[model samples]
Target: MIDILYFAWLRERIGHGRERLETTAPTVAALVEELRARDERHALAFADIAALRVAVDQELTDFDAPLKGAREVAFFPPMTGG
Candidate 1:
């Protein structure tokens, strides 16, 4: 299982901050597709991939990144400078 975390508005939209998912997804993008297919909340949260930033094992990564042995994945809006 992998831990999937959602931050800020993503969390609000999904109605949960985190979840442990058991998936056979090969990449971040595939993982997202799996989640999106689960419910409307997930679909809406991932509606705009361009507006989202992803992290794998706490390190920033792209949606195409491989997820062979990743333990954690997080999604959130792109950071803005103060």
Candidate 2:
């Protein structure tokens, strides 16, 4: 199983902060597609991937990043300087 973490508005929209689940996705994008199929909350949280940033194993990466052997994934909006 892989741990998925949501931050900021993502967490608010999904109604939770994190989850652990087994998946057959080969890449982050594929995992997103699977999540979007789960329910309205997931779909809404993932509706605009362009507005989000992803981290695989705590390292920032593109959505096309491979998920092989990955233990965790995190999603959040891009950080901006104040």
Stretches of model 2 off by over 4 angstroms after superposition: none
What Cα-based lDDT does every candidate model obtain?
0.97, 0.99
lDDT value for candidate 2?
0.99
Residue pairs with colliding backbones in model 2 are none
- Tens digit per residue, CA lDDT, model 1, 1-82: 9999999999999999999989999999999999999999999999999999999999999999999999999999999999
Off by over 4 Å in 1: none
For all candidates, the clash counts are 0, 0
TM-score of each: 0.98, 0.99
Q: Output the TM-score of candidate 2.
A: 0.99
Best candidate per lDDT, number?
A: 2
Worst 10 residues of 1 by lDDT: 14-23
